[model samples]
Target: MDELSWFRVLNPNSKNPDGHARSYEIVNQNYANKTIAEFTPHISFTNYRACQEYATANLNAGCPGKSVLDYVEEDTLELTDPVAWVNVGFHHTDKDEDQSPMPIHWQKFQIVPRDFFAQKPTITEARSCVNGPTGGAVNSTTRPCIATNTELPTVSTDTEDPTTGTTLTATPGAWNEARTTWNYQYLWFRDGEPITSLDEEGNEVGATGETYVLTAADLGSDITVKVTASRTGYPSGTAESEAVAVSGGAEPEPEPEPEPEPGAVTSKVKASATKVKAGKKPTVTVTVNATGVTPTGKVTVTHKGKLVGSGKLKNGTVKFKLKAFSKKGKYQVAVSYGGSGKVLGSSKTITVKVKKK
Candidate 1:
């Protein structure tokens, strides 16, 4: 059986001199140790030399006065190969709950990530999507900056026996959320197209947890399903199951990969005002035009190499409302198109003048 475990992250820029940024600890306990040893043997070591001597020491007499933690606190000696030890022991008090057939117990350790990232790793930029410089330009509604959950959920499919199976069923694992509850939506697919379930009245409905009965038309296809989980305020997440082939059906044909498009898409950025007073918000729009294809990707704006804003492209452009500048100066604003699979990337730089507040 697999054990359940989690880890923690630490800030790398922490001022602690020990540089104890990250550490992973694993502790395993054996109940037999309590009975066989004098001091209830605990794994402890100072350095490579002490570890060598301790391993050779007789089990009859465990380290009498030197625990690994003790050595760490007391000894200032530097070591070439240092080792830290941790102990996991089940605690018991003289209470009624300490019966013979004990309830499930756990012995665990922690893995810490110290000073891992300079900032919150998942932060996203604030920006808005608009059609153009028309009525929707300044009035565009900004999409809330929500991070997509990339952790795939677990799904299993059951089809009874291989010979006579005509129906397949799928089950989804619980979506675990820390601060809120998760609601789930499921979708079923044959090959790559969607499949829907029908209610008793024959009205189409969601295919969540529904059985998929095989038909003559679906004889050569494989079946798969996907589940999306979302909370009221949090971003939504999606996960898909591995495709399950029909019992005695022809193998599904694989879809061909699209070839990479030839020419690169170009980007041009224009600000609403060439000059604006400090603390005044200005809108910047990036137009990504291709000769023969529509560009689909994100546009990122940087001011003197610092990321200012970013947004996704709709139609052929992405718009960003620049935050107010606190200081007045001439700034170089650069916009880059992070091109999609069918489009190559391009960038453009422009200058914006900011006056005194």
Candidate 2:
């Protein structure tokens, strides 16, 4: 029998000084190809007592050379049955250390057994029938043959302003997945699109898993969020999760407040005297036509670029008196609706001809 066919034995009793029993085999001397007994001795209360009785009885009954029994003399012996079977043909070794050992090696089978019932199939072989020859055959079966349990991991999105280092919390929606455990091939997305870096060019920066971390740049204005999940095992190509939009982050500043509409006022300034005599006062009137603005402040009159007179407008009109006009051939007169800083309406400039008087 092969090494796999030999059953490993264990000792269970604490009182037993002997440790666990090793693998052992039983073969027929007349028909070396045939196996008589293939089992490991059990060390439990029941099995240990049974093995002890059997070993003692067999050793006393059969001839010492033909019947060989090996056991641990510990308080108790524990053992397990051989889980698998293998073929070890031909040579034999000495049962005790005193005996000269035979050179035991693997020998070819004299004749290959055809569908032998004695040899049992391996665990892997039993499972193979359940899982057909083709890949993913289990999923295609109409009846449920396989059951799976899944545990989804939590995911979060975080963003920080590069300049200010201000942190912003991004709301990470639910990660989508057809099944909890992926088929172990292809990229998986928590939302919709494949998880990628926040760079301008969407690159495959993250690992090929369901969870994804989005940086500040990735959460920019143009970026939209969606979850996608996929794997190779399923025949549906790639399975996708639901799409979820990410929220949070500083919004752009609002447009500047509109400036107040300009005051509706039109003013005209003119000189009454065409020719002005030296040391003579020149009379001037500043008229304004404004629908909204109330003419309340004093009007400033200027002649030849000099402040000659000042007066207040009673009802959108102002008349001013000029004193001691300087000697000149001609001069320009400008009237301001309000005096200096108090200007509210409008201002107009007119030509004034000055003559020697």
Candidate 3:
């Protein structure tokens, strides 16, 4: 189509240069064959009269001068397998500009983006790197996003010494750092039906909270405390205590074992950039810490809920170089420290946005 005039679609309010779809075309002096006659006269696109005529026309009939739209006599435009018609012209006849050794003349145009991106793709903000004793230089090229997780957090129920006249205590599971909000609910079930009681406020309630005291009605019956936990981004979860039964008669019971003190290790994750290009790796640093002690552990990394990488900690820090994603979008990374004998396991998560290279 280098011998005819051509044009492009434009959005007047677009922020892109020339307000077009990132392309430029100039009017010329030649015409291109983009009609049904030029369409190879093969398969019919629809049952319309124009489509049937174009598909069955003989080659000798030659291409028509009128545009494709002229063939449609109907008021409302409707067609299958639509095709665009564009013509470009560039006449190369004898002229002052066509001298034997005339310098090459060039015309350039481009379609710039407008709203394709919510904001500028390269407008990423800098972030702090995870700094631990064993830490290396922080990555300075990645773009960061708010990370989120969908996996349900671990949930468990605890009971006070079962021998202490059937007193039960419930301890909620730890919440993930990515979670923004959550709550807990306690319930007791017998023979698959819920058992409830009136709270001190005289409101009817189920066996609730972190503690439960056995009653006379519980004798010779199985008791269970179920704790339901929820967080902002992850799915809600319920954990039930192992079924315990009230004995037939009062008898001497073994002393309950003391609970082990929980470790105090915590961890944080830092990413080189919140935004990165597809096929470009992003460096992630995880720092493990304990309030009053040095931390040691094997760190595991997960994207979403799937494990992606793992490594051993050195000087309370672990680093991971994520594999380049083949496509562009937001991805979440979770780093967890599987604590040593003196530390507790902890995790941190962050979000990364991938862009075109």
Error of 2 at 262 (Å): 8.3
Residue 10 of candidate 3: its Cα lDDT?
A: 41
For each candidate in the order shown, give its overall lDDT on alpha carbons.
Answer: 0.54, 0.38, 0.49
Write down the RMSD of all candidates, one decimal each: 28.9, 31.8, 21.1
Consecutive 10-residue window with the lowest summed lDDT within model 3: 140-149
Cα lDDT for residue 119, candidate 3: 35
Root-mean-square deviation of Cα positions for candidate 1 versus the true structure, in angstroms: 28.9
Better of 2 and 3 by TM-score: 3
Deviation (Å) of 341 in candidate 1: 41
What's the true lDDT of residue 149 in model 2?
18
Over 230-326, each residue of candidate 1 has an lDDT whose tens digit, in order, gives 6543456566665555445543342332345565444343333246755355567777877677877777777765565677889987776664453
Residue 317: error of model 1 in Å? Answer: 34
The local distance difference test score of model 3 is 0.49
Q: Taking the tens digit of each residue's C-alpha lDDT, what string does model 2 give over 181-210?
A: 333333433222344454557644743443
lDDT of 3 by residue, 253-352 (tens): 3233223246544444333333665545566677776777766657766675545556677887767766445346888777666666666566777776
